[model samples]
Target chain A: MNLALVFDLLLALMLLWSAWRALAAPNATRAVVMFIVFGLFLTLAWGRLDAPDIALAEAAIGAGLTGALLLDAVRTLGESAGADAGGARSPWRWPVLAFSPLLAVILVVAVLEAPQQLVDLPAVVERNMGLSGVTHPVTAVLLNFRGYDTLLEVAVLLAALFGLLALAQGAASAATRESFLLHTLARLATPPMIVVAGYLLWAGAHQPGGAFQAAAVLAAAAVLLHLAGLLPAWVAPGRLLRLGLAGGLLVFLAVAILPLAHAPLLTYPPAWAGALILLVETALTVSLGLVLAGLFLFLSGRSLRDEETR
Target chain B: MRVAPVLRRTLAFALLWWVLVEGSSVSWGIGLASVGLATFASLRLWPPAHWRISYAGVAAFAGWFLLESAKGAVQVAALAFQRRPDLAPRIIEISLALPAGAATVLIVNVLNLLPGTMCTDVEGKILRVHVLDGRLPVVEEVRAAEARIARMLGVTQ
Candidate 1:
């Protein structure tokens, strides 16, 4: 009845519509665009849920990075492949169609039957906030309470990059696309981007940003420079590159292990907690930036080996 | 490579850092290092172009650009509701007097931002612009925009 409820309903509808369109779109490029639109809608939904941190991550990583990767994939895979894939009707289609509604019903019933709140997690987090060093609950949870999960996340990202590197047969350097306007813009934008990244990292201690968000912004700057034909695509990891790629995980693991010498894993001294978190975050920002940008760079360039093999 | 330019760029970057961090004195240590790195990176990426910019001219252009964009948006919106819209879509190529650099970039963006006209491609000194209504004097408008930008950047005729 109220305007807010109406707006929320409209947003939900739009999200569903966009997701459906993304799946059903005929052209591969159009489908990718639709998927990006869906990601934006999902970001808005996260914001509506009052989860600004999730919204930022969703917008930057889910929508921006994923969309760029998908667009690049489309380009590399060619339009014909997308067309064939889109037009083809798989054998499992009928079975999936029949099973989807049953699954949805089961999920809805499960949600409806579940206990509302067996534990007051927020209250618990609030009570122990003083010990976490970080002022923000989300930051505390991510960096202190559940740091092992973040460690695994960085390791997973590293493993993924390693897999990408193994599969990559591209040259160390290639001809960069040139644009006068873009080149100038890239130069102008890079400084501000760096400042923003630094600010985001600093704010993470008491705000909605952290290493992941800062890393994404830093990666975006590199992507912009690459797109503008300023920065070159990466090939195999050299000594410096290797250090940059693995530095965050190394720093994080070292921090985790240091506590193991006395305390349990990943437990910093009460006095050094804030400084250690900042250190870990700084390392994560640099390493993850390289990794995220590597995800794009490795996939984009033509392989020199392809010609030799051919 | 000049000390004056390097210092100027560093100060600009420092101001930006201060603004971004909301004048947090605690961040100055990292902020100073970041500003230095940004200045160094910028110097490498962007070569000295001997640009002489007029702040007053930039202000004037910005004001005019905002007004034009608003008017253009309204006009385009009105066109959408017309019973029988008369749309003449065509691409017009024009040779620009301004050399390819910041000024050219500015004009290209200005053309793209304004409603009814979009810059599709720029090949050397020639710019290809797509216009919603071919009847509109897109060529003259682009030329006018180019002139204004040239003035703003203090580009020589």
Candidate 2:
């Protein structure tokens, strides 16, 4: 077999092994960690398949954020019942094991049976790319051609955040401490990294960096502050904070509103479209980072200050 | 009974609604009526009248936050590839300098945004975090984060 095929097989094996371990690991922490590894491997596989955007998202959101959340949940559960108390075991473990692999095999078969090449690319994407007015093909498809999906995705994110907040019912306090090394690192590294993240956001119009990537980077920074105890858990978002949350929706709505004035829905002014997209992406990065962080902290159910007392 | 802040928040929500539903042009009468109704409803819902704005503090905090997040991303990425992931798990407790509210929430949420660390709990002024690689000292990280947040909330410390 060729090198590409060999690589795909190895990745597929890694995914399967990790997934199996994640499901069967006796410890919840190990299970979560395994699942995270599975997610990373899945991203690598997607990259091999030439879907870099999906890979980036899967790595950042699926592996990184989701893993952190799962680990938090596991830690909380462990603490509540005393540190030595292991979580309850699944009663249907055997049945689940029997069924899951079968389901996976079926999925693999379906994927293999799918058509190898695009059947209507020219008419579907290339033909209508100009009409959308966005130079980026994926963005065109996401914001214009299939705008409804993008709207729904945003709604899903918002809903998930709100639902998580409702379930968790409290927030964590900030931690306070400092060391020479952390101070030096933060001072030397933070500015340049933020600049890079901004550059990535701006370059996303023609390159791989976009709202999602930029937001991941931003969220990473936010995570650092939380770790350092620089941010607090109980600080409520204000009117402007609310505005930031609603910014993306507003921009999209404005774009759609223009359609009623004889312009196509989401069609930007020709000269300023790039600038507008950049603006929207930047807003989205901040909003997304904040939303995800909020969800995690809320679910953790303790303020940073409270944490220190324990 | 405090009414002004509730009224303001209601007005803000109405404005947001208007912005969101841009093309659906209802008459000005309807918009004004809705705003008035919202304000009244909000007053009843939030019987207390206490709202504060600290713009300078928030700006400082945001500036500090952006910087902190960048540092975190690099640190976590490096940790992920380390030979001994297990040796790095550390739990640290941080003291809070701000009041229990939005600023605090922002701090904890931002912590989770970074990789390799998760906020375990927050009570009063203390914040607890679980670091994947806990061997490293977390105090400095906490101090820097606190300084930024203190600046953001206009709390002198």
Candidate 3:
């Protein structure tokens, strides 16, 4: 086989290997590390498949944010014990093992046989590019063609944050020991990060970036500031904080509903489609950034007593 | 004047925007706005400091850093290959001459990147370093590196 094919094969094998390692790791922390590795491999696979948008999201959200959350979870859960002491004793193991191979075979057959039966979805999106506000097909699909999905995604995120806040029971752990190195880094790097986030937001109209990616970068900057002890974790949502947390969905819904008086939901008039999409995406970026960062920051203040009570 | 840092940082952010946007003329409108916002944020995050970095000094320090890193890597490789390697790992606390800002941070990070010495902790002016071999003039090397960083940042002894 050629080098590209060999590389793809290697990537697939690594993905499987890492997935197994993450699932079968002896302890929680190692499993989280392997899970991060798997997410990274998945990003690479997406890149190989020529989906830069998916790759960026996977790297930023899947590998980076998810890994951070899981690591914090492991620490909070205090599950340093080996697998035998934890989840290995689940009763469903045998039935799951017995059915897994058959399911895998069925999935393989379905995947192999599906190409002829399925519509060329990308071509369909390409045909509607002129009507969709953005030039990028993925952006067009995410914000215009499938606006409902993004709205729901943001709603789910807001709900998740609300749940986190409810579960949180204390103020921020005594101001993290100030690390001068981190402070310096946060100072130097934050401006560039913000600029990059803006660029991503702007680039979404014609390229492989959009609100989600921009928001993820912004959240990363916030996390860096917290780690550097420049910004404290949230004690409670204030007026402005609440506005930022829910502003995106509110804006999206307003825009989505504005057209409903004359037409179907989210159907932006062709003349204002580009501007409307940009406005919605900008609002989404800010709100989503806060929500994503809140996911971590809210949990930062959580008390062990809450865990005990649970 | 009071406005110098603002102007300089805004200009820097503008240049950064140009580079990030790859000189796209159409993108400059948003770029200008972003540069302004970023500049404002940066100023708030870190107010003006007296430190002025010298590019010539930076280039010199970078070269020295590269050379030291190469040498350190080779030494570490040799140690790894040797059976029953003569090892004397030690943690030594050394007083830092550089001030509490960027120079100290730079040296601390640089030491971590270097092969043998690791800056494990920094408390006020004291730096706790862990070196793989204590006999390798670790203290002197750290001082030299710190001196280089201080020079680069235009900091005086």
Question: Clash number for every model?
Answer: 0, 62, 0
Q: Which prediction has the highest lDDT against the true structure?
A: 3
RMSD of 2: 14.0
> Each prediction's Cα RMSD?
2.5, 14.0, 2.8
Question: Model 1, residue A164: what's the lDDT?
Answer: 86
State the displacement of the C-alpha of residue A111, model 3, in Å, after optimal TM-score superposition.
1.6
| Per-residue lDDT over A207-235 for candidate 3, one digit per residue giving the tens place of the 0 to 100 score | 99999999998898887787778788888
**lDDT rank order:** 3, 1, 2
Q: Of the pair 1 and 3, which is ahead by DockQ?
A: 3
After the best TM-score superposition of candidate 2, give how far the Cα of residue A119 lies from its true spot, in angstroms: 4.6
Lowest lDDT sum, 10 consecutive residues, model 2 chain A, at A79-88
lDDT of each: 0.84, 0.63, 0.86
> Relative to the unseen true structure, what is the C-alpha lDDT of residue A247 in candidate 2, on a scale of 0 to 100?
75
Give one digit per residue, the lDDT tens place, for model 3 in B1-157: 3788899999998888778778877646667777888998998888888778899998998898899899889988999899988779999999998887777788888998886998889899999999999888888888888788888899886
After TM-score superposition, the amount by which residue B122's alpha carbon in candidate 3 deviates from its true location, in angstroms, is 2.5
Going through the candidates in order, what is chain B's TM-score?
A: 0.90, 0.63, 0.84
Q: What is the total number of backbone clashes in candidate 3?
A: 0
DockQ, per model, reads 0.68, 0.02, 0.71
Q: What is the Cα-based lDDT of residue B71 in candidate 1?
A: 75
Ten consecutive residues with minimal summed lDDT in candidate 1 chain B?
A: B25-34
Which candidate tops DockQ? 3
